[model samples]
Target: MEIDSYFIGQLASEEKMKEINPVLSNVKVNDSNQLQFFIEVNNGLDIPADYEKYFKNQVIRCFESNLNSSEWDDLSNKGRYFRDDQFLKFAKNKLFIFKVDVNDSLIGTRLNVTKNSLIVKEKPKNISSNNEKTLTTIPIFRDFNVNKFEKNILDSKSIGSYEYLQEIRSPYIVCGEYLYGEFKNFEKLNDGWHVEYEDQIKKIPIDFNKYKDDILITEHALYLDENFLYDTLIEQGLEKLGTIITKENKIYVKEIDNTTNDFIEEIISEHEFLSTYKSNLKAKNLVYDSKQIINFHTSIKTRKLVILSGPSGTGKTQLVFNYAESLGINNSKSQFNLIPVKPSWTEDSDLIGYLDTINNIYRPSETGLIDTLIEANNNTDNIYVICFDEMNLAKVEHYFSQFLSVLELQGNERKLSLYNKEFIGRVFNADRYPPEIPIRDNVFFVGTINQDESSNSIPDKVLDRCNLIELVTPENYIELWSKSISNSLYKNELKQENKVETVTRSMLNEWGDWHGENVLNNKEIEIIKQLSNLFNSTFTIGFRTLNHINSYLANLPKNQELDREEAFDLQIAQKITPKIRGNSEELEKVFDEENGIFKILSKYQFKISNQILRRKKKELDIYGYTY
Candidate 1:
């Protein structure tokens, strides 16, 4: 058997071998043309008591000569050891054989060895200490030549390469056989890495340092070096090689997709719209309190119908107009339809479309209700708002009864019949008008109502179906005027069409689920139950009120600094208390100020003793009716 020269040299220089067996001496080349060393055990001679220790030292020396210093150091750190007897057993089995070759180049030297038919590459000298540390961590790609792979591509693609790939201006790295580079004018194909570059189908690589840009990567690609890529990009600037992260100590990085970007943009747009809407409201001298604004937005998001009911001259109509204008819906007749409620309206045809036999044509009312609904149905991407200015002037149950029932239906069930089915193509133009129009989720309704002798009272059915946001004029006239003047100047400089996009159904469902699961605690449910018990016979609430309350609490903007109980209090004041109206003695018992009914409903956390409810109760007691 041929022994390696390095192992033979280590055995020859080992003093422990000499001490353990004095007959064993220097190594020499044998006739077989192999490095030879011998050990002779004398008869009747006892070996040293620490013979095992000496043998172990020789085995370590052999390991030190053959293995790399880093490998030996790592093995030593791991507390690995081999007994002399173990080494002898390995040698007897012919397992100590190794074939190694050393080569030198102008750039650096390399040590190549064979183990189980796989070549073990030598450590490069050019690698920094930081990179060496990183290498130790990433064992999966320890044998991977990332630098050579990148260099080979750069060399091969230097000429006659695809123009789009060559035009990549930002430096990137390759991971998992996919190139991630930064380049402008790259067409986005999907939410993942699939792309069409220069009209050729290709897997578009993600941007290296420009991750915050419009580029996105596939989840499978991200998993390869998710943790190490961020640090590598930061350390090497934009041009460095992508480092392989150690698989053992995995770093988690969230993958970005088009859906995530869209969701983030939606949130940002909502915030921006809210800010601009507030500014516009101030510009128009319509000062809505924070609660009113929150409830208004929440109402639109959750229920799609909101009632602005308060005394006249409180800017209720102006609030609706300003809100629409802030959302870039300036065209009153197109995006928003203002229908004046007439006292003579007592049936569904008064508000909904009616068939006219005159001139052999089915004519819609001048209110443009059908046209607005048609526009909303066609353009589902935008938010369409309709305002019933002075809606209480007529009995809402008569003219708005169909809407009251139709709004309760969800999804595809939300449809309203315009006229007879035969009239669809014959009388009413089929191209522009259908027999029944589907009430889309994107359309929201707002009604400006007043409690007076001329207007009819809004019944419990209507009150329960909609969220009531009472508008009160600000008492601080000086501050209001100052804000209005400041906002008017700012409004003139801003773009006129700051339209806010409609939130998707998925987003609303997500918020609803999150709030129902996380935000609504047991204490709030108990409070709701107690409030329901207060109006036991008069106006006890069901799941509808509970759902509205939950949705209201869920849809409130995160930045709004309202406590949990305070938010619930606002829901009670807006959603629940608005429905409580009568001259019954039980009603008097619930609204009694001394009994603290409103306070109790709010869990005694915040006071809900607003003048809206008080005025309604006072009017109900005096006139036996209130809206």
Candidate 2:
């Protein structure tokens, strides 16, 4: 066998190896050309006192010049040395292997060697220097083309080596399969990388020189950095961001992953009819205080429902229309929608909206009033109103409960349940659902009520929600009737001939003067007493009827205006006295002869008992003793 290296200890003698050798004496090379051998360094002897020193001093040697290629291979085989490529790669420049005792525990005492077995020593530390020093170094990489794998690794922005990753509880270096970093600032951060989609991670440095914008910030507005390591990133970005937020606690962000488009048109249609209103006539001079004007404004501003309850021919509907028209004049921006409420409207949707039978579309009728108001106010800031003519003929609570609740709902928009299948029979169908109506601040509601046997009684809740205004018919109905007839081009088309002859304008005005001048200011009781006593012999008046008459008379024209003057004579008036009744013999004699008008005038006129009674009798007989 060829010996290619020198040994520190002399080979054990043949006599010594015969007793302590632990392996077979004959050995051969394997396919890798490596040999196995054993020898007795000590023959039944205790370890040497300098055994540790001897082990440290041990070395292997090679004689390259003395051997041919085959001879060298043979020597390598005899030495049992194997070429390890992986070990060579790891030990390429800075790493080396030095044979040391496997049990050695000292760290820096370890030695290093090269392929040629050359030993190198570390420099000694100087003891005299006392300078304070800090050594900071970042790992540097030689130029290496980044492959797809490496690109992905960096994109992940991981924080440790591959081997170091397994030992760590979380493999941060390969976090989402990216290389790791411990960058102190954004400039040191990895760039020149692309992601599959968009990358949300952003970096902002904290140094003052790089910060161009405002750098002092609060903790509330911004948060998070590329790696989500600390809150410093949030503080820094917020410093640079410029925005004014007046309301406190108003800034935030959220990840909305699953967004969808829902119903949209119904929402738009529900808020289309917003409006504002004002009175046709304001009494600025009628009252000294602003309370009346305040009341007027408040009446228009806060109106939800109004009920004008009065007798027929009091111009109730006309007044409501006038109010609505007045609002049109003031609010020229848009016209208020006017809807006439019929007595037959019983269901809620009848006034709101319903699916049209002919066209299969949602149509708004009377209930359309509310829908129109909601639509007018849709998604905007404006005012609106809905006037209901003859609102109380139908049950107010039955039709208006939903409307009242909708009015009270606080949101700018009110979502109506139009398509709920459960509300099938009660209202509209599933085909048409009214979208939420953006609530407008200025939607006024007005209603008119005629107090008649055909009209329904108004509920107290409805009354509480309304401003009640009373109106009465004019006392001179004949004048109004005659004027209406005179203006009519259809006078010959009258269905009733007797309707023309029932009351004449001249007769009514002449009869109206009989009530005395300034009848409007007279007390109701005084008018009733005088009217009943004066007409006791002919027509009589009741308390309730007198009240009605007084209300009518109050609005009558006090001073008459005529285009032409008519002929008239001195008025002869009659009044009954108790003396006329007590003098029965005189009464009989007055009745026996053909009593002239002066005789009747004396019998009835009490202030002048001797006045001509026969003339009064004829006058009374012709006029039928009118009160």
- Largest lDDT belongs to which candidate? 1
lDDT of 1 by residue, 233-347 (tens): 4345334543332213333558779775764533323444565667566545566665567557767777557889878777788888877776666565767777888888888
lDDT of 2 at 580: 26
lDDT of 2: 0.33
After TM-score superposition, what is the CA distance of residue 160 in candidate 1 from its true location, in Å? 49
Candidate 2 lowest-lDDT run of ten: 562-571
Estimate, for each residue in 214-306, the C-alpha lDDT of model 2 and write its tens digit.
221111011111222223333334224312222132335565445564422211100010101111221111111112222222234332344
How do all models score by TM-score? 0.53, 0.27
Which residue ranges in model 2 land beyond 4 Å of their true spot? 1-297, 329-334, 355-361, 379-382, 411-417, 421-433, 472-627
What candidate 1 gets wrong by more than 4 Å, as runs, is 1-268, 357-360, 422-428, 486-519, 591-599, 602-604, 609-627
* Pairs clashing within candidate 1: none
Name the TM-score of candidate 1.
0.53
